[model samples]
Target: MSKPSRLWSIVDRRIHPPLLPLTTQDSQRLLDTIKNSFRAQLEKEHGLTDTIQATPSTTATNKVQSISNATTEPPRAFARPTDQHLHSILKNPLFSHQQQLKRQVVPASSVESDKMIFKQAVAKGLMNITRAHGFLLKVAGQKNTEPPVAKIENHGVGTLVLEWLRDSGQHRGLKWFSSSPEFGGLLIRFLLAEGHDELLLIWLDQLMTKEVSLGATGEWGITSMVFRELIKAKTLDPTLDDAYRTFLTGMNMLEGYSLSGKFFSTAWRELCWSTTVLAWKYPKVPAHLFEPFAASKLAKDPRDPRAHELPLAHLGLHHPEKPSVELALEWLRRHSFGYPAKMLLPAGSLEMARCLERLTSFGIDTAQHLLLSNQEEEAKGVMEYVKKITKILREKDHGLLPEAAP
Candidate 1:
């Protein structure tokens, strides 16, 4: 075999039948054909010209001449890039890869592109329910109040979610809402504020089937807000009664068993206004319902001018049949005030007498403290009541009278 044909011998052994071995002439012919074919293919596929300039050895040339009479084609010149051709090359994957590396140090385009594609996929309903839910949660967690598209886009998504729940009846979304009350509350408020009360009512009824929890701050629960919203519209009270009772039951389960207390610290003014509005409209809500909250820390201190003031005002001003005066007096007894006598004076002569009797039962020292703790006009009124009570008691010769009187 010729010197240039030696490389083809190895290839020939792999391809040829085991029984057939190539002669020197056959090997040289195969070598010439293979080299020319390979060069043509490299130029056609890679746009690279053949760089090798060495001529074939005389033995290889003579072998090629003896093998075939066909003339070999000369190698094409190297390609020069015109503007359009260079533009096309730049658009190819390799050139584009280099361009991308130059533009983005971290290659954020794919990440951003992925985000956009994901959003589009969700918007187009191309994603599965799990993917859709994840996307919705991401959107919900975003700080934006308005939907990314037109204002109606969120409404559409909201409707779609509800419809999905209706079809699947999974209860997964409800569980999510219960677990994430803040996000759930935002969604609910948005729905109500947008006048989607029917939809709000529907979701609320569905949600109420499961136990609802209070928020982190012990403020209004999801059920409570929905219940209150229904109450505000003066619609669906009958439908919401069970839910409201359930909500109140949950409220009573709080550490102090107090809804008023829950709302007082978080939103004192709203509590007062809500109490007034509700009490005025529905005067017959049993006083027992208010009992739990009345005894809470929020209501224990009569010194707190705002504490329990609304419920007291509501009971005293509107629901006189209820134990308004007794609650006020209990408030007084529970709290040691800077001016204890003043709080008693507001409950009228009957309650005032009962409160004094209570203090006196505790002992002369307690009664003396209640009176002596005040100054100004209050002290004068307390002293006179003490004197009158002492004279009456001494006349009756009751052991309740103290030996040392004011």
Candidate 2:
């Protein structure tokens, strides 16, 4: 047996010559002739009349004539219903409301238009330099009354805002991007330039509470820098303790550097930099936490596990930590670096003198050989720097270390 032919075959058949044109009057006349013939047949077969009354004399001829004329006449173009009028008549307000409720939607074309406008605005602002920040803020749905930089209080919204700021701020200068306030100003301007503050803070909280793994992205370095900067500035906020704890927790998660680790490639230098900053700002942190990081970053062997490091000797001493053997040794090594040579007679030289006294009291012989060992040149200058510190210590007669409290 064969399958039956589909009705669509006939329904979709193409016309060769297409439709024949008909004049309005001719069409009206043809329609009237067909209608009258049908009516006459119905009247003869069923005895139906145009009028309901069966009077011998026709009393409603005018009404019958008017009905006949209406069916026979062609509709005038000016009087015909437009598509808009037909749509209005066909659509009901209640039905439209129900449709909207079923699926709240914006037309895709409009959404695409909006996204394009946003991109163009961002590009223009970035290129102009002067208007970049203002343009970005406006495009992010910020109102005129709202500040350019805002603390998004709502967690979800704030996270989104931070993400936007991060991506947009990356291409702009540090000053323009850092102009906004966040975390009550504990943010490192450099990290802010990196545009990961929200996620950084989230990781900070998660790591602090041990709720998360050290899942990568070199978060350790940023956390370290943030804490170091905060300590250096003496910006004591109540939440800082928890934040610092998180940084320690994140540091512990690293099982030593490896090629396969997540975010490992980008995180090493950052973490190294953090270590340098922390070593400089040692007194503000716990000895136990600082010791391991300080030791690892200062490794002497080229093949040592933590040998790859960046130089950061430019940061000068300010509000120096109370003198200790470890602190003094690291200080001397850092100060000896040619890029940041110790000043001959600066304000903090007195603090350096005190550190030297403490180093001697603790017994300089105990200081590790690798403490001063960098490249050969760096190693050679170590004793000279140490002697200078010792001389200052003797001349100042500051033989005691400050109390062991931060």
Candidate 3:
């Protein structure tokens, strides 16, 4: 106890000091000392004798003000060239007055200006076409209304533009503009607004047949828009089946042209999904409508990885009501080791299971018909073919057979 008390007494005395309050005079003195020290430091560092400078005389101040005023004055505006200036520049001393007058009076050609104005007019007309179709109505917070057919007919803006292009021999411009999907789509809409279905089809045919290079691959050019619009029209009116069929025929016809055929094949592959959707909507449409596509060499070509997989798979899965699955089975039978058959048999196990079910049902139906006709041998073959396929598929995936088997 004595040793500990002695150590604590020494620590308290060394570490803790007595608190003391300062008077007003003491606080003022402390602040003056700090201010003097800071000012002295700043003056020493900046090489200044005094922290504040003396004010200038009234005359010096006035001189400075006048100098600032002179420097801050606004710049003068530019002036136009006078007739004298123009004459000095234009009247060469070597030429006579009559020759100079004749040269000045000769008119400048306005051809370039007219061409620029025509191009601007074409751009504006295209914009107006979109506006006529309610392109801007959404921007103005308004519901879209039908295109003003009466106004379009009265103005004849599109017609007049086309006529000018044709009459003025602007064939290149006309062809490029007509081939543009933007312009082509607007023109189609305009024609539809005017109830010119026959004209629309004719224009579409011309566009498809034109020699112009189809711009940029995968761009969904004029042909794609034609199919889109035709599909939309078919959806609204089922009787327009012939319209779609006619367009398909036209597209198929393009397969014969060398340059256009390449484009058509690409477009055909891309639009296979759309065709599947269309076929699904109208199952009554005959299977032959798509048979040409499914049976096309392009669909069966082994070189293209995307060739056989899409068209037949889409038909089998989506357009099952048609003879699409039959077409797929026939394709598989022919190309047993090809990519598509690989997809049907192994890679797409679940899909292959479904196809087998459909094949079995189809086989049963045929076998029943054969039995009714007293063709026992043919019926046995059909049944045996169905059994062989089922056995092969079951051996491929034993786990799926229990769930897939009826």
| TM-score (C-alpha, index-matched) for candidate 2 | 0.26
Q: Which window of 10 residues has the lowest lDDT sum in candidate 1?
A: 147-156
Residue 45 in model 2: lDDT: 59
lDDT tens digits, residue span 1-406, model 1: 5465544665656447973677776667667667756656655566656434223586468568743642243333334323245544543332234333334334255434444444344334455455544545454444435322212223334444444444344445355454554444444433543557566656555444443343233345544454443333321132323323433443343323323433323322223233433333333434454443334454433236544452453334333244333443343335423223232243234544544453343233223334554534543444455455534444434444333422
Tell me the alpha-carbon RMSD of every candidate: 24.9, 22.1, 29.7
Residue-pair clashes, model 3: 0
Compare the candidates by lDDT and give the number of the best one. Answer: 3
TM-score of each: 0.27, 0.26, 0.35
Model 2 stretches with alpha carbons more than 4 Å out: 1-198, 201-243, 256-283, 295-323, 326-406
With candidate 1 superimposed using the best TM-score fit, by how many Å does residue 316's alpha carbon deviate from the native? 4.0
Cα distance off (Å), candidate 3, residue 365: 20
Candidate 1 lDDT score relative to the true structure: 0.42
lDDT of each: 0.42, 0.36, 0.46
